[model samples]
Target: MHQHDRKIRTIGLADVSEPGDEALITPEVSAALATATDIVGYAPYVTRVQPRDGLTLHPSDNRVELQRAGEALRLAAEGRHVVVVSSGDPGVFAMASAVFEALEDAPQWQDLSIRVLPGVTAMLAAAASAGAPLGHDFCAINLSDNLKPWPLIEKRLRLAAEADFAIAMYNPRSASRPDGFARTLEILKEAGCGERIVIFARAVSTPDQRIETVELRDARPDMADMRTLVIVGNSATRRVGRWVYAPRQVR
Candidate 1:
C-alpha cells in the first residue's frame, strides 16, 4: 500500500447515514481509499454540505476555506497522497466538479496525479430499494437555486413532465428552499396526468429510511428535505404494496 503513497486519490461520494449506507461507495472507491490516510469527504448531512468545510470545492472567496483546500491540493501536487471525497456520486451534484474547477484555476495542480472514484448515488440506492422506479428513461434535476436559478429548474421540470419521463429529483427541499417542491408539483400536474406515480425516498440506505408512493396530485412538499430523493414515475408506473416498478420489457 505504501508503494501507492505519492498518488493523488479522490474517494467517491458516499452516504454516511450508517455503515450500511456506506455501500454508496463503490468497490473501486473502497480500494482507492484503502491506503489513504488523508481523506476529505462531503459532510454526511445536507446542512453541512457546503464549501466552508472542505465538503465541496466551489467558487468562494471565503479566505479560511480557500486556504484549506489550496493546501490540500498543494500537498497532493507535491507528491503527497491526498483524498478528495464526496457524498452520493461525485459525478452528480457532488464535489468532483468543484475539485476539478479549483484545480483548473490553479494550473500548478495540472501535473498532479488525479483520480476520481465512483460511488452509489442516493437516488440509485433508493430506487433499488423501492423496486425499479428508474428502469426506463429518467432525468435527474437538482432543485437548489444556489448555483442555478429557480426559473431554469422549473423549466426543466416542465420539460420532464411533458416528456412523461421517470424523474429523479435531487435537493428536493432544504430549510432555505421551501418553494421548489411546491413549484415542482404544480408544474408536473400541469404537464402530466394526475395518474402519474410519485415515490418519496428519504434517508435512503440508513436505518431511518422511508419509502412511499403517492399519486401525482397527492405528492406533498412537507415530507421532503435535502436528504430525500424523489422519483416521479411516468403514466406506466405501478405500485404494489411496498414496491414500485416500471415495466421495461413489455411483450
Candidate 2:
C-alpha cells in the first residue's frame, strides 16, 4: 500500500481555551492536552501549555488562522493526535471556521475525525462579572473590520440598537483601529442609549483581569482595547444597589 492508503487512527481536535491561570483551565481541556501529540495555536496560548517531552507545540503570530488550521490538519492526517487551540469559544470569531475552511480546500482530509471542546467564552464570563447584564436578549458583534467591511459592522450596530439587545462587542479597540470603537460609542449614544450601562471586562479570568461599569453616555473609547470585552446593556438594563443587571422580562 502507498503511504496515503493507510487508514488513519488518530484525529485532530480543536478546543476553545484562553491563556490564564491553571485554576481557570477546565478539566476536559487538561485531559485533551495530556493526550495531544501536537498543539497548534497563537503564540501566547501555545506558551500557556506546560511543555512535555513528547508534545510538539506550534506557535504562530496573529491573523494566520488558515495556515495554522492547515498545519493541524496535516499533522492529523499523519495519524498524530493534534489540538488546534484558540482563545474563547472556537466557534465565536475563532479557529473552528478556519479549520473547516481549510478542510474544504483539501478534500482528502475530510474523512479525518475532528472534535471541538468548549471553553468558558469571554462574553459569558464578562456578563457574569458584571452581574448578568446579558440576562435578557443579547447579541455579540466582533467590531474588528479586518475581514468584513466597516459599513457592515455599522449596519449591525444600528440593527442591534434598534432591537434593544444587549451588545457584547469583541475586539472593540486596538492600536491600529483606534477610531472604530469611538464611532461605536457615538452610534450608541446617537441611538439614544446614553442612559444604558456599559461594562468593560479586560483580560477576564486572568491575573490581569479588570472589570469596569459605566453609563453608555460616559463610556470613552480609550477605556477598551484588544484585551477588553465590551458589553453594552439594553434600554431597560438597570442597576440595583451596586449590581448592574438586565431584568428577565423586557418591557
Candidate 3:
C-alpha cells in the first residue's frame, strides 16, 4: 500500500531473543514494520526486519551509504512506505544523516513525508551495561577515517582528551584499517589519559557479548574489534563493585 493513502502507525517491539537485541528494535519500530512497503539498509540490519509476504527488503553493502539513501528516497517518492533501517539511532553515525544529505542535493524528494524513529544507540547500551561511565559529560566519535582526514580525527581526540570528556569510540578497528585504533591509543596516552579507566564492550546485549574494563595504561589495541564499542571514562570515573561509573559531580 502507498504511504500517502494509508495512515502511518508505529509500535514497540521487544528484544527478548538476545541480551542486546531489545535495544536494537522497539515496539514502535515493530509497529512501523507492518506499514512498510519497503525496508532498505545494510545487509545485516535489513535481515533483522523479518521477511513478510508483502514486504520488500533491499540490503546493500556497507560503503554505499549515500547511494542507499538516494534509493530509499526514490522509493519513498514513488509512494512506497519505505523504512530505512540503521543499527542504532539513525542520527548517530548512521543513515539518518546520509538520507538527509541525499535529500539536500535532490530537492524534489524534500517534500516527501520522512520521520526518523529513534532507537537505543551503542554508547548508551554500553554505558548501561557498565553502570554509567558516561554519567558525566561524554562524546561519541566514529574512528573510521574513510570520509574524514586522519589529522582531523587526531585533532578531535586531542581536544576531547584535553576537555576530559568520556570518549566513546565506534568502529574502533576494522579489517581495512587495523592500525588506526593502535594510533588512537597512542594519542590518548600522549594526552595524559594513561591512568583513566577504559571499558571495551563487545557485541553488547548479544549472546556473545563481552565487557572488559582496565586502566588506560594497560589497554591494548587488540582488545577491540569492529563489533566492540570502546568507552574511556574521564579522570573522575571509578569502579564500584562490578560496575564502573563517573559521578554526576566534579571536584
Candidate 4:
C-alpha cells in the first residue's frame, strides 16, 4: 500500500511487568524492539498502582503516572515508532489499555503502527515454578484498593475460597495498599480448610525470586506484596520442594 514502495515501520514494545527486574524482557522482545529507531517502556504498578522514576506526569496525577502517559503521547505525535513497554503480558493488568486510553483522543495514532507482543505474566510464571498450582481451574485477583473498592476485592476472595477453587493473588501488597492481601488471606483461611496449601512465589525467574509453600493459616501479612504471587491451593493442593503441585490423581 506504499506509493513509494517504502515500508512504514513502527516501534516494537515489550512488557516489563516487574519493578527492579529485567529478566521479564526476553531476547525475542529485545530483537523486536531493537528494530525500532527508538524504544520507550512504561512499567505498571507492580505492588501499588503508581508510576516509576524518569517518567513525567500531567500535573493532576502522580508524577510517574503523568510521565508515562505523556511520553507515549509525545512519541506518537512525533511519528516515531513508539513502543510502550509494560510488565507481564500487555493485556494482563499491564499498560496496553493505559496507553490506548491516554491516546484515544489523539487520532494521529490511528495511522501509526502499533503492536503488543505477549510476555510472561507474573501469575503464569509463578504458577509454573510452583508446580501444578494452576493444574486445575483457578482464579486470579489483584488486591490493590486504588481503583477497585476493598469490598469488591474482599467479596471476590470470599467467593473464590468458598467455591474451593485454587486462587492466584496479584498485587497482594504494597506500601500504601498494605492491608489488601492480608485481609484477603484471612477471609480465605476462615472459609477454606486450615490445611490448605498456600504457595508464596515471588520474583519468579528473577534474581531475587523466592518461592515457598505454607498453610493457608500460616501465611503472614508481612510476607507478601504486589510483586509476589499467592497461590491458595484448593483442598487437594500439595507441596513439593520450593514448589506446590495440584494433582489430578484419580481415586
Give the number of the best model, judged by lDDT: 3
User: How do the residues 77-108 of candidate 3 rate in per-residue lDDT, one tens digit apiece?
Assistant: 77778888777677788888888888899997
Computed on alpha carbons, the lDDT of every model, listed in order, comes to 0.71, 0.81, 0.83, 0.64
Residue lDDT tens for model 4, 1-251: 43212112222222223443455566665665554433444323322123334332222223254356556666655644445555677767655666666657666555555566777777777887778888877888877777788899888888887877888887788888777777787787678557898888887776777888888788898788656878888888877666678787623
| Candidate 2 structure quality by residue, lDDT tens digits, 71-176 | 8889888878887877766678888889899989999989887777676677887787778898999999999999999999999999999999999999999889
TM-score between candidate 2 and the true structure: 0.91
Pick by lDDT: 2 or 4, better one: 2
Cα distance off (Å), candidate 4, residue 149: 1.1
Count backbone clashes in candidate 2.
0
Highest-TM-score candidate: 3
Distance (Å) between predicted and true CA of 118, model 3? 1.0
**Weakest 10 consecutive residues, lDDT, candidate 4?**
3-12
- TM-score per candidate, chains pooled: 0.84, 0.91, 0.92, 0.77
Q: Give stretches of model 2 more than 4 Å off.
A: 1-19
In candidate 3, what residue range of length 10 has the lowest lDDT sum?
Answer: 8-17
Q: Considering lDDT, where higher is better, how would the candidates rank from best to worst?
A: 3, 2, 1, 4
Q: What's the TM for model 3?
A: 0.92
